[model samples]
Target: MARNTIRKDENTTRRSKKELILRLSVYLKPYKKESAIVIGLMLFVMLCSVLNPYLLEIAIDDKVANHDVMGLLEIGGVLLVLNLVAWAVSIIRWKKIYSINNNILLNIRRELYTHIQDLSFDFFDSRPVGKILARVVGDVNALKNLFNQSIQLLIPQLLNLALLSIAMLMLNVKLALVCIALLPILAIAMFCIEIFSRRRWEIYRKKRSNLNAFTHEEFSGVKVVQSFAKEKDTNDEFKHFVKNLKKSWNSAVRLNDMFWPLVELSAGIATVIVFSVGYKLVISGEIAIGTLIAFSMYAGMFWRPIMNLSSFYNTLVTNLSAADRIFDILDVKPDIKDAEDAEKMDKINGKVEFKNVGFAYEEGADVLRDVNFNVEPGERVALVGATGAGKSTIVSLLSRFYDVTSGEILVDGKDIRKVKLESFRNQMGIMLQDTFLFSTTIMENIRYGRLDATDEEVIAAAKAVDAHEFIIKLEKGYDTEVNERGSRLSLGQRQLVSFARALLANPRILILDEATSNIDTQTERLVQRGIEKLLQGRTSFVIAHRLSTIRDCDKIMVVEGGRIIESGNHDELITKRKAYYGLYSAQYEFLNEGA
Candidate 1:
């Protein structure tokens, strides 16, 4: 089984790498004009490289040795001109390459981000934020070098090698034959390096990804670590990841370092052979002194490309691993998407219905089963259940965060799946127990609900939520900066700000999952009034841990074991003296004890 698993992994890696190469090539298609110019310039550079040595041959044999001082000076001037042209071509090529590469990278990153956003909430539920972030920020960065080296080094080196080979054949056939003989041996050596080095590079990339995931998770939860006094434990855990990364990096680098020395050695040996055989040819009057000298120069030029090619192979191996990871994300099909012929759903009456809705994050572990419910256009419904009873899951389905596994959800008599995603989502507002705010000012966070909301509208939303009083009392009022995750604000304050945001969105369908669970009693009263105001004339779903908060809701639902066990108005449920009654009585006693 273990061997089978390893084989499967190997096959997956190979497939991913192939797919990565193919998909990345698509980005280059848009830059064909620039690529053509670059290739032309590189060919020009290669021409200069090939001609420089031949020019030397002429200067030595026909100008210098013949004592034609003016001819030598003229040849010198031509050589300088050739170099200047190559330099200018190189400058223009570099700028174009940079522009093309940067644009490609930007497009790739943007596509990844947009794809991630389109994915269903279930995709995020299975992966950590840190792991996803590594792919977006770190893995995407690996392709930067891939494009840079491709045009700048790989193409030019290959062109130079081909042109140099042709020049050598024209100058001296015997020396060219010798150079050709050495290529097969060098090629085999590089082929061996690439084969042996790829596994190590893959390992190195995996370790680096692991390290990044751990670092991001740890730092983001630094407060929890400090509160639990687990600093030492966390540090030790981090060190372990560091140690693994170091080991993988060392293994990869060791293999990578061997490639250079081996290429250089091959080049050196080839040069020595040229000198040994060419000297004999010159002595035998088979070739001129200048020809032998030029042959020697060409031999060096040939090996330089071989060395570069080997280095490029090493780079390819490293980047292929990163590319595989990036494509892994790109290839994931979004679990939720609109139907092919989905229609736009603009104005909604806010009537929501669940027709035998059933869902599960994993197969056979249903979180909701045959759940049927309905709410009028402006009803406030509260879902109450024990932990893991799927209250939040119900709300998630209502908001279309995850599609129902067995049935359908409809808004204003229209199936949500048949509506355009953006059009459907724009009509709804959702606020979770953990109110998240960006590391920006209060005004901006509220404005996030509606990007085009005027300042007056934003203030109106704040006032509607009863947050304006506290906003004005703050050190900078609406302009005050809320630290990351709104750490700078009190928990109650964050809830109010988030409430303001939801209010500003003016969504017809509002879903709040434990929105007030974190607030203290005093603050809960303050927020309760705002919540009442927000719920007016809007269909709302509330999931709450505190039963008292839902007593006034039009309908109270009791969920258990993925089924709605009881549901009714608070008075009706209390009259039954069943599950809801027991829950309320228990909560009432707990509150009295606290008092």
Candidate 2:
């Protein structure tokens, strides 16, 4: 497979941030009651905050200036009460916001996972597991701050700014005008910075995704890296990815950092102007000292929200790329889906046919061309070929992993594509060269073939593939817990368990592609005996590298570059002395030489 690092579809029609934000608002609808309560609490908090500075003006200009100590004490007591109430409400708001964030993110990740499961193998073929993990995990996590800080503050911040401006203006309009003088200029500057910062943040996200992909792929294949003594090469590549991420991080952070300082400096200069001018007004008695002080403080309050809004906007810009990446995966339509009116397949007898079927992973690069074959009900057929030949591709087409680029496949004379995927796939069992086992007990692993199967049924499947003995020998027997991918098990043991899994499914049509290649000669013979009995009544396809494993197969087809060059029973192919004959001879001699 090619190294497919690009996760986003370049051809996808880009959506404006407005559209994305509006779509995100839909999630809020479900939590409207909680959201409304949070908003109400924030409003009360804002009211309490803004009223204090006004009360300060009242106490100073009315009570303190008139020598009324009792009135000043009452005002101070009211201020204390308001602060206590605000603090208590603020705690509740924080708790509610956290709950909302978790629930919304849960919903998004659930939808993403469900959508991905329905997508075709073609979607996975071009993207590494690491890149997919990055979007699902890291990218989703990046939206947390957006929800907590940005969304929670959005309405509150605007309202806060409005209240502060009104209070400042009511105190003294001259100072208010001077304090807001630079806002228009700040807005223009923000617009310009955002345009450039948005692009840099996107680059930063892509670089992080690339690093994730490279790291995951190397770790997955770490065994190969060490076996081939490529650790130095791999470490060098790792360093390159790290350095690229570092550079991208610096570029994106430098631009984003400019916002906070810029907002602060502008507000600082405005405050200086307000106070300097207001000092003259107080002395001239155009405004009292208390009013001038209150107005200047309110001016400060007004810009604090502006600073917060700037911070919120910056958060949006930073995570917008993450949202785009997430939506990109969701936007991909499954390549292989049942027709709209498709229905469940009829009970299968496992009579299968490939009628001039041709397939390509890429356009005009056919992997299987004009492939034609049929397996009669209850027949056992083996496919043999060198690496890169169309042997596995043919079976993959039969299983509907990828639709044929040309021609069609029929199961029981019904088009597979016209049948619902779940209904069709349920009747077929497929075991690939690499068997993947989840981190669970061995019993649970076998029972995955049929979730409702009894312990007896699972054990029977294991006994059928001769996996029962080794399974019992484990410290935990059938309940033995396996690590991820069953790494604790030997290759041959894992293969045997995989065979048992396929057998437990009791599929009408079974395909085993290089399933027994990892087993030893003795174990293969034992497995062969059990498989022979099981193969008596089901149409099955087997692909193997060892020629001896398939000698008993009813027929053998020798596949070459996207075509079947020879087909016959084992003895008949040997007599013909063609492609199958040569392949068998070479393998036979190699086995003897090894002995």
Clashing pairs in 2: none
> Tens-digit lDDT track for model 1 on 424-492?
889899999889999999999999999999999999999988899999999999999999999999998
- Cα lDDT of candidate 2 equals 0.87
For candidate 2, the TM-score is 0.94
Question: Which residue runs does candidate 1 get wrong by more than 4 Å?
Answer: 1-12, 16-19
The local distance difference test score of each candidate is 0.85, 0.87
Specify the highest-TM-score model's number: 1
Clashing pairs in 1: none
Give the CA lDDT, 0 to 100, for residue 174 in model 1.
83
> Lowest summed-lDDT stretch of 10 residues in model 1?
1-10
TM-score for predicted model 1 compared with the true structure? 0.96
Candidate 2 ranges beyond 4 A from true positions: 1-15, 571-577, 593-595
